[model samples]
Target: MWGVFSNFIACEIGFWIVIILGLFTRYVLKKNKLGLFFLALTPVIDLILLIITGVDLYRGATATTAHAIAAVYIGVSIVFGKSMIKWADERFRYYVTKEGPKPIKLYGIEYSKHYLKRWGKHVFSYLIGAGILAGVILLINDSSRTEALLRVLQIWTLALGIDLVISVSYFNWPRKKDD
Candidate 1:
C-alpha cells in the first residue's frame, strides 16, 4: 500500500514537470516544435505508469482505493491532456498578441458580433464535452460509489475552472474602439 501510494505521488510529480516544461518551451520560449515534442511525450509517460499499475495488479497485489483512483486519473489525463494544452495555448496567444477584438470566426463559426456570446458558446461546448466524459467514466468505473462520485465532481470542477478562466480573460480583454 505504501509502495503504491509512493508510486502514485512520484508519477503525479513527474507529470506536472513534463507539463511545465512543455508549456514553458512552447509558449514562453516560442519553441513550438520542441514544446509539442515534449507535450506529446506526456501520454507515453502516462502509459508507462499505467503499465506499472497493471503489473502490480497482475502480481496478485490487491488494488487499493488509491490505486484505482490513480489509474482513473491517469487515464482521464491522457484523454484530455493534449486538448487542454491546445486550448490554453490558443487563449494565451490571443491575450499576448493584443489583437483588437472584432467580429471574427471562432471555433468554426464565421462571425460572432459579441465576445461574450462567442465565449459563452465556447464554454457551453466544453460543458457538453465534460458531461460526456463524466458519463463515460461513470459507466466504466467499477470503483466505490463515493470514489466515482468524487471523480465526477473533480472533472466538473476542473472543466468549469478552466472554462471560467478562459471566458473571463476574453471578456475582460481590452478592445479597441470601433471606428
Candidate 2:
C-alpha cells in the first residue's frame, strides 16, 4: 500500500517539474511546441497519477489535495509562462526582423493566415501521434509494470506535442475582432 502511494508522489514531482521546465523552455523559444505541450499536460498528468496511485480521483482528501496542487501548478504555469513567453516572443521578433531573409519577413502575414495553415498541420500531426499511441497501447500487455510506463510516456509525448502546437501557434497571429 505504501509503495502504491509513491506513484502519486512521483507524479507530483513530474507535474511540478513540468511547470518549472515548461516555463523555462518558453523563455528560450517563445512559441516552442515542447514547452506548450508540457504546460497543458501538467494537470492531466496529475489527474492520471491520482488514478494510478489508487486514489479515489474525485473523493475525499486525495481529490482536494490533487486539485490544490493542480491549481498551483496551472496558475504558476500561466503567470510565469506568459511573462517568459512574451519576453521570448519579443526576442524572436527581433531575431527574425534582423536575421531572417527580408523576403520571408515581407511574406509574414498577420497571424490569421498562419492560423489557417496550422489547422492543416495539426490534423496530420495528431493523426500520426494517435497512431503511435495506439500502437504502443496494443503492443504492451497490460498485465505488467511496463504497461503503465508505456502509457505514461505515450500520453505525455502526444499531449505535450499537442500543447506545444496549440500554445505557440496562438502567438503566430494577433487576434482579430469578430465582425
Candidate 3:
C-alpha cells in the first residue's frame, strides 16, 4: 500500500506547491496583477485539453483524488477571483480610475483592510469551486452525458477573461497616480 499512500502524499504536495507559488507570487511580491493573470489562465489551459484531447491534467491515466483536488482549486479561484481583482486594484493602484480607493466594506461594516486580509473568502471559494469542477469531470466521463460540462466551463472562462482584461489594464496605470 506504500504505492497508494506515497502517491497521495505527493498529490497533496503538488496541490500546495501551486497554491504556495500563487500565494508567494501574489502575497509576498505583491505582483497579484500578474499573478491574477496566471491564476486565471492555468485552468483555461487544462480545460482546453480536457475538452479537445480528452486527457486529464492531474490524472495522467487514472482519475485520482489529485484531479478532484485540482478541480476544487479551479472553482474556488474563479469564484473569489473578484477579490484578487480588487486586491490588485487597491493594493497596486493599477488601472486606477478617476475615483479614489474605496474602503472594503462587508455586510455594511467598514472593514478598512486589504482584500487579501480576508483569506477566508479566498479559501472558501477555492474549496467550493473545486467541488463543482470535480462534478464536471465526472459528467465529462459519462459517455451518456451531454455538453453541459463544457458550457459550465465556458462560463468560468468568460468570467476569467473579463477579469484578466481588467487586471492587465491596471498594470498600465501610471506610477505617479498610484502614489
Query: Scored by CA lDDT, what does every candidate get?
Result: 0.60, 0.48, 0.46
Put down candidate 1 lDDT per residue, 1-179, tens digits, no spaces.
67777777777777767766777787778798998787778777777766776666556565565555565556466556665666655655566544334323343222223444545654555554455445534554644433533555576568667866665565456344454
lDDT of 2 by residue, 62-173 (tens): 2233322333333333334444444444554456435322333212345545554545554444454344334434544343423443444455457557765764666674
Top candidate on lDDT is 1
RMSD of each: 8.5, 12.6, 13.4
Candidate 2's TM-score:
0.30
Worst 10 residues of 1 by lDDT: 103-112
| Evaluation by lDDT, superior candidate among 1 and 2 | 1
Model 3: which residue pairs collide?
71-130, 72-130, 75-129, 76-125, 76-126, 76-129, 95-170
Task: List pairs with backbone clashes in candidate 2.
Answer: 33-164, 37-164, 111-173
**Candidate 3 TM-score to native:** 0.33
TM-score each candidate: 0.50, 0.30, 0.33
Instruction: Point out where model 2 deviates above 4 Å.
Output: 55-179
Give residue 50's lDDT in candidate 1 (0 to 100).
Answer: 66
Regions of model 1 farther than 4 Å from truth: 90-179
